[model samples]
Target: MKGHYRKRGANTWAIVVELPADPVTGKRRQKWTSIKGTEKDAQVALRRQLHDLDTGKLSHAEKLTVKRYLEQWLDSKARSSISPRTHARYREICEKHISPAIGKIRLDKLRPLDVQRLVDSLPDKGLSRRTVLHVFRVFHNALERAVRLQLLSVNPASAVEPSKPDQADIAVVDSAGAAKLMDEVVGTRLEVPVALALGAGLRRSEILGLRWGDVDFDDGRATIRQTCQLVKVEEPSAATAKKKTPRFELRFLTTKTHRSRRSVTLPPSVVGLLRRSKASQSERRLLLGAGWQDNDLVVERGDGKPVRPDTLTKQFHKVSDRLGLGVTFHGLRHSHASLLLKGGVSMKAISERLGHVSASFTADVYTHLGRGIEEQAAEAFDRVVKHER
Candidate 1:
């Protein structure tokens, strides 16, 4: 039987407890649990807490240190509400970045200045501004969960100023530069694929995910219904090995966003390039029958497997470096959007082609690129107002 609980403070009270006999020590001991509220409330609270201890609900009540609490937060996160890729990123940041920096620190004792010092020290540690921000974001999210669960009274990360990223001028490759760059790829293995990326505003992953069947020459359009992404895995299981391991398959999966999965009209130049690339692939398949991988459309090798997306960046950089273009593979997509904008394409039309959920997003990213049109608009405004003024 338990004794009567006594009020210790406003919204809190304490209960004297007898520790169970220790066989080795051959003695019982006294202990105490400080619970919050009135006598009846404390009774109910202590009973519920004791129940929780027996049922594993409050398993950590006795040993819920900051590190333990952080682990529980991370574990719950991994089990729900996140994609594998996103979860992996969070896990890496927690383990490699945040935990190493402050894992042993008491969560309740963590001051805003302590966090600020970490952010302040990031630049000296060779962390990129973006990476430091990411580390802070991970901790912020974890601590937010802690606060919600009553493990933390408040989010310490929220009180600290977040690290800011340094801004670089938006890079946009213009029309003439795009044409000159396209000319550089005219003779290489990258010709057709690079053309599609530059001309269609297709992401490199989306291009690699494309298939010959996805194109409609009669309709003069191609459906961007899928995107390829790399995922690391251990050795294949028996079931996976039997079916050619679908991760490696050119298995058509849905696009990343519903807005991105759309039918885009192909230009005559790109349509011809696709025709040529397909015909060339067919000829190569005939040459190597059993040796061909044969799962992807925009394949890089004769083996027919889908092209690795990162290789495109490497190749693009190589070409850009060779040509002194000051552009990137991603710059090709920017070039595509820029040319359309410069040619007086409407934001809605460009958004549709680029698969942006909203034209506002497109407008936001290319504000500098869109400024040229604003300049023209201002010139027209001057013409209209100059005589009146």
Candidate 2:
């Protein structure tokens, strides 16, 4: 109910606080906390503890280690609130990065320096700056939940400054380059999928997850319902008792965001390409008969199985390398937006077509392409002025 501090060393103090008596036994209770700072800081800490007691938010310190707490968090809070892929990623970050660094430290005793050291040592461990930032964020989120649950008085990660990654260059293709890519993929397995990527602005996952039912040849639109992802799962090998081998399995998950589950109009050329692909698949299905798997994927192998997402990327890389396009498969999506912008499409329309969360986000990603549009606008304005005069 009340608290006070006494100097234990040169700048260290012990804060002792009185607690409500035990219910049945009527025994007195007290909690002690150590502060390693000036007397003023000790006073502030005591006040905070007392306030927490008054508000029924103070909890007894436990001997829980960071590793144990993170495991519990991932199993309970994270599993329920986040997607399975995200939960797995968070657990991987904890195990591969944070746990090895400071997992043995007591949760309540974790300090800002400990967290900073973990972050600072990551680049030396061959982790990218982006990866380092991601690890910090995952650890910080777990600690934040601990604070909300009254498990700790503060989150140590808040005091640490994470390294910022440099801005990544966005690769885009011009009209001529897009034409070259299209021509290179003609009569190849990537033909229809590449057309969908460039013409419909579909993400790679969306393209692979597409089904025949989702496309409307008559309407020239395709509904994005799900995305395909390759997830790593643990499989126990028969030869080993306690050893687990990680294997990847393809999963069809709901679209990344609500806006991502949208319908995009297909360009006429893309529609024609899809029609030809459909007829080709139908012929293969009949030829294989019962031998076909028949998953009904829009872009699949000849045996009617889903194409591996990585294979799609590698194949695209091969074509791009040969053509010297210098653009990635994902860059096809960027090229779609760039072409639309240069063709005088409205930002809102383009955003919706690409299933972006907002037009502002679309603009931010395509800001590099704005210069050409600006020049075109200035020329139009000049023409209008001369005609009016």
| Best model per lDDT | 2
Q: Candidates' TM-scores?
A: 0.71, 0.79
lDDT of 2 by residue, 4-111 (tens): 899999889999998765322346778898989999999999999899876646753345688888888887744473456787898889999999999999876888
lDDT of each residue in 1-389, candidate 1, tens digit only: 24446787787888754333321233554446787667788788777756543443432222345565567677787677444456657777777766677667766566677677777777787989988888888877887776665445566777787657764465656767778777888867788767887899888777878877788999888889777666543356787675533243223445757789898898898898888878888888988899888676764556687777777678888888887888778778878898898788998899989999899989877777788888988898999999889
Candidate No. with top TM-score: 2
TM-score of 1: 0.71
> How far out, in Å, is residue 200 in model 1?
2.0
Candidate 2, residue 1: lDDT: 66
RMSD of each: 8.4, 6.6
Q: What is the C-alpha lDDT of each candidate?
A: 0.72, 0.87
